[model samples]
Target: MPPFSLMRCGAYLIPLVNSPLAVAQTTHLPEIEVRGPRDSSIGSADSASEGAAERESFQSRPKLRPGDIVEAVPGVVATQHSGDGKANQYFLRGFNLDHGTDFAVTVDGMPVNMPTHGHGQGFADLNFLTPELVSGVRYRKGPYFADSGDFSLAGSASLDYLSALPAPIVDVSFGSHNFRRLLAAGSRTVADQTWLGAIELEGNDGPWQVPEQLRKANAVLRYSQGSSARGLSLTGMAYQSRWNSTDQVPQRLIDSGEISRFGSMNPTDGGRTRRLSLSGKWFDKGRDGETQISAYAMDYRFDLFSDFTYFLRNPVDGDQFEQTDRRRAFGAQGSRSMPNRIGGLDGLLSVGAQWRGDRIGEVGLYDTVARERLSTLRNDKVSQDLVSIYAQQFVNFSDHWRGYVGWRSDALRYDVQGRALAYGSLNSGKGHDAITSPKLGLAFTVTPQHELYLNAGGGFHSNDVRGATITIDPQSGLPAERVPALVKGRGAELGWRFQPNDDLTATVALWELGLDSELVYVGDAGSTEPGRASRRRGLEATLRWKVVSHWRLEADAALSRGRFRGEAPEGEGDHVDNAVERVFAAGVTYIGGPWTASLRLRYMGPRALDTLNTVRSRATALLNFGARYAVNEHLTLGLDVFNLAGRKGNDIEYFYASCTAGEVASGACGGGIDDRHVHPMEPRSARVSARWTF
Candidate 1:
């Protein structure tokens, strides 16, 4: 997505949203005056969804994964996934920053929220996302109002699309993982109206192919009108994806002197996702101001993975456990605007309403030595509904100061009718619940070039923790546990943001966070009560600068400490999941018209793998380099050389071998033992690519 697409699309949407929302001639940044998606764009393509708010994000090539983009903001850190080839995760301010918190991620407004129990080591399909369809991307740090839900602990990333352009574009690239991709987009003007379309396909024969191969495609279609003085516009789209299931690795192979062996030796994905959306907006800016309404729907599924566990950790005998998931959802949101003043400066008021509904089902089955189906987990049903109302104000005090604040509340209700998980004495359980949530936020600039902010927020999660998945809880009577209720966290940040000019942007922040009701699985033995309290505090900082357009420099670093506030006799919060001591990122880029080059170095400090903290892990750093060059007006080329330093493992890596412990590693037997000290990771590799755009 280009930042300019929104400005272009907004050239027409502004009237429908309200003409008062449009940029006046007086605003200093003329290049981003168009109020579409982003508020600014630098060396990036003219089109970007950068927004008109104080937010944070990692930066990366559009063709790359979200993990590749974490360099955008300060304090955020991500590690490569080799042991668990799942979603890329970032440690937000020394705490666990998974799909649940730290930040919410979305593509073209589609939220990606999927998490498993116990460890934060799972991955989803966002890796398949391609940047070709993105027009703009918005990021927000801290609490956001009803518009974004209460899911963000560190922040949120919002992406926008621009389907309209004077010309058509197509991009194609190939590299490692048997990696290959094709992305194409185009726009057409008709009867004074414009329509846009995009299609993207990515496939890889991933290096760790213990039968692991991935292929995916995403398509989009949208339409808009010319400059709409009447303040009215409309857009719609559909998207779909299909891929192989996540492969778990076999522990024995590593102990047998094979650290980089594929476990299953034959893995496959049996899942797919499909979605569609349509929205309408009416901004009678021709009248008092602007009013807008938009809505969308999604349909998706996760096919059964028949005993892929043998791929991660082997049992004497191969067993297969697979399940299928079917899901559908729909929602809409509308906002109205009015003029105002803040600190005797220009300001705007916005009021909005939002609603959505969801339905899901899961089916399970067993696989035999001959790959025959056995039985299935009983069927299940779930329905959820959400409605919210919110208002916000954006104020520009002067060329040197700006302020923003907002409030929102929600009425939520949901129910589940299925064979709930069995926790020893607890069974035959089905449940229903409802909640009302409120959120608030504020940001102020101490100077035009620096800023400070504080926010308070609330939200809930209907974690679809299937009953069959068991994590032994710390209790005497209960053999297992069931997942229920939403997790909540609140925190504050004192930070400074400085943009000396378009050439550079930097930030530093110190923060403390509290998760009031989040769940954690811990204890020496299965016990009765829930987990104890937990706390996280940390410091984060980053700096980015464009040097003479021909050279760019960037660096980000984070330091933190976290732990269980109190020792629990039995229950969750026994230990921290994503606690880290330090993280750093440094990069440089050079642009020479048709050719652009970039190099990045990443580092992580040593960390503890267990709560005992008796043993610790090592630290590591790697260098990455890449380049993009134009072949012609419609063609371009790109390549990346990662882990150029060829480090064996990262900070989170830990492994045990025959030379170590006795019974514990032997798991009740006297056999030679190998304890997993830390998660395993992949080493240095290289990738290359090419593309064409019109």
Candidate 2:
């Protein structure tokens, strides 16, 4: 029996057995200390032991890029290989991360959406955030807080820089994929005044065969003094990361989870940006109150080649693609928290308001073919402006319980010139839409060693007012128009936590979510239609224990099912690529004299190919192993290997498709017809890294 066949058999057989794999609690964990001072484990794979077991536990150190982040996360999927590592996209909450701009992204309280964007993921360039530089990542499913207003559909990713540390520090790393990393930060503390500065860089040829390459750099600086000094502070951060590749690779065959694709898929895509922020804080003594205000702005540009025609054999027949975009933003926020007795309960009230707007362009500046450029965006200039107001209050319902509620309203305006194309007398105009989002949660401690909780929240996203005119139905001959559709997200969860023994703790949670205006495939290049509400409901459970000194273990698993609610007719490209069935994770840690090691395993069920919407995966399980040694109190060495046991993992494919015809396109091609199958993951790649304290 071959490994793939065995895996297929286990997929069906394992469910029959309640106890598929035995897992114990954890006592000691591999401490891969991150930006924080404590030697705590970093990375999403090394989730913390708090909260819900598997479904929504706070995971740290998750991969930062689209491929690594979305691939490992549950309830999300992506398209596979495009030759030379080009055309990498993700199916997030069932939508393509393709255009880049649609899915909202933010870093340290700043938006990444561009001023103008088509109906895809091109504008949302998260590659700028290097995974290693990230101290921690918090992925909140469904609707989140108002501060994250830009994107709340597929949840959100919150990134933070190192906090509460000295002004100066340095870090460097070297790994597989021809990877190298460097970080340097300087800070000064003079009594009540403090100063900080830092720089970071990550470069790699990317070890994968796609022959892709990446380079990233970042800088940060801050200055602050005592409260009397205008209660003001200055902090700024900037980043630039680029991806270079040949484009798409076509897939042809698969066996034992490894795929063989022939033909070439080629293209090029990447982005760059700069951001800055300034804030003020004031504490009132007469009445207990804390307030903060912020002013911020960002300028970014993205360049891409999504035209698969680049590899159509005949240079004239190929579609050369490129979109140059620049986006800018300015905004302000004010909030006040006051301590008081609300209905005999001690709590606080917070409220604020803000306004923002952007000028965007979808210009087809240059392309290999002139006709393709004109057909793409000959007369494309769409801009949007928005203003909003919101308020939230936190209250203590009882000694062991707390709750919060919030509401917001928004107004919008849009501009465009149907010059390149045609529009019925529809002129640039303003529109208004508003919704009140609310959140409520409770925490209960039944006993000193046990706790229970529940939470429910709502969020909204109206379709882009700009994309309504990309391409009218090629079949209908009707004028192509992109209309903004109102979208909403709602979720509820119940959970419990228990500590039966000193060294063991466990968490169990049940959750369900609904998202409106889902992007359903409409069949055609750069085209899609909004579907009704989709439901994401599932169960998550985890068990962790420290059986004894020097030995620790943890187990976690999640089962989610997502689908269109009305049983709507399935189109050629209609599919749910989220982790519909199961995702399992387990880890073991061993600490010995002068040496420590840990082993981790992750199992993911199959998914549908985003493009053709076919269920094709054969199911896969990936194993990762890591070990480290202490050279002394001041230094340590370690080896970490992803895909241990040399298991060749398959590709889930990001949600978009495009091709290129660069010089390196020959070796990059794989599948024939859009090469649905991507090459398997590398057999086994390992990295040795270390750190020292002075």
Candidate 3:
């Protein structure tokens, strides 16, 4: 008889049973042994802290935003600093990440990070994602893989969507603060091809004096043929959102009872954004080996109005500023893998290439009040291009030992054209650079249930083109120093994975990373600042246990230290500001015939807020609970409770000097006085949902 196996599609694992004749013909074939959970042991050495999460893991979690889906990765934390329309703040391995500067994110093989973005470099916004279509998530927590390059110093994640669904589903939800949402998704097969479609509509009025009236619309369409390993697919997506914002407030104002914690300094603060994209992928498996190719094109627009200093810049206009970004981007990637034999030993060789480009029509900053632009501070057009090629070889020296070596080279070019504005002509220049990264990995199988691994690699992150050749600061008109087009990173890891039983899996890793230099473009100032080189070391541990047939438990913990590389002068400290030191997460999940429940706790530890360590941020802990009950074969009801403990904490905190109405004359208005700026966490909230499957 032919061999049979199980294939996972969405939340179902369907059995692929073979016919009697086929099974009888294949009975003489060699036996294949699949190891570890979901074949996670395939490349134990090539990646440290890398694995996949099942669909149930995502469906069971209580998430407020689509970006929260990334929190499924161990030791990864996602937070929000401003409006709901913006990208979530991401932190991993002691790096602040800052809108995805060090970490890379992708959805269905399409890159999510925007290079040279008006708000920040490598800005990654996940608002467009439809969580219901997600099939699985694959993540790696180090720069130990050759396939990932730019913005992957801290780690990388790839989210995949199901090509087909078992049935159509319609979900409607209502919650406190006037929150409402509706989603419809389904798939159909015709002429040996599968087509999938989804649409989502959401609206909310947050608990704030300004009432964050957020409205969003999202849609997706996909067509595919064959299986994931050898299939062709085309996907199109659209998303749009607009919302009012309640930005962080000064602690002095809140402490003096001048305003509430959820009060906004500028009621006009808000943003609008839209994205349209088309992507395609093709894969083939033949007698020789396997090959895969992908291509994508995208159009995006963003407009934001913000006021942080609240009268520090223009006392008359109240320090409100507007930022605008519009761009078109395209990219392509292809790879081929082939089996080989070396000295009577089995091995594999892979080669890949990628090319991407972005044409930004308008990236501008303007002084504004009440959403009206007063004057343009800077305006320019940017064109950026990147090309990379990589090769890797994996060899099996023996049954218990294996190793891999990889090399990658990347080339980048930047071109900027200034738009003459009232604030003087913006700097226009062109620059290009190239870098080569190498990776090495080794693994040893100690026993059937235990494995050890060691990995070392190099990675990099690109800088904004405006910061690479600017001669004058657009905000201050002072001489501005240019930074390197690409900053290099080096990292190493030692790890172990153990599966004592079918129900228990554990992993532990110790890693360290160093950077050549820390240079970032300050969006608020329209200039680049050079920071000291830094080093980070950390330890991460994770546990997954299926306690029973209907219950599971998961726990993860991470501790890290970050500091400047060189010695500091008198009165100076080596601490890295905003670098998180510790993070912990635990969750319990239950799945039965008609009832499901989940409870989760997340903790973020305190860290320094200033270069001198004189100021520090307070730790925060939050609890969330969710439950779902199936009413019938096609009906289900669900409820989620956020901030279950009703803890009073801040979502984010920073120490900086700002000016206010009463403190302008005391030498503490324009950068003299130091006070904490805080964005408090949202209080307890509840949401109820009903889903119907057809």
Q: Candidate 2 residues 39-143, lDDT tens each?
A: 111111111122222211112212323335433333334334332223344444334444332345455545554434542432444554434333444445545
lDDT of 1 by residue, 457-538 (tens): 5544434433323344312334666545444556556666666577777667676666654433221110012334566777
Error of 3 at 419 (Å): 1.0
- Model 2, total clashes: 58
Clashing pairs in 3: 1-23, 1-24, 2-23
* TM-score of each candidate structure, all chains considered together: 0.76, 0.74, 0.92
Give the Cα-based TM-score of candidate 3 against the true structure.
0.92
lDDT of 3 at 665: 52
Error of 3 at 15 (Å): 32
- Taking every candidate in turn, the Cα RMSD to the unseen true structure, in Å, is 8.8, 11.7, 7.6
Candidate 1: C-alpha RMSD after superposition: 8.8
The TM-score obtained by model 2 is 0.74
Best-to-worst lDDT order: 3, 1, 2
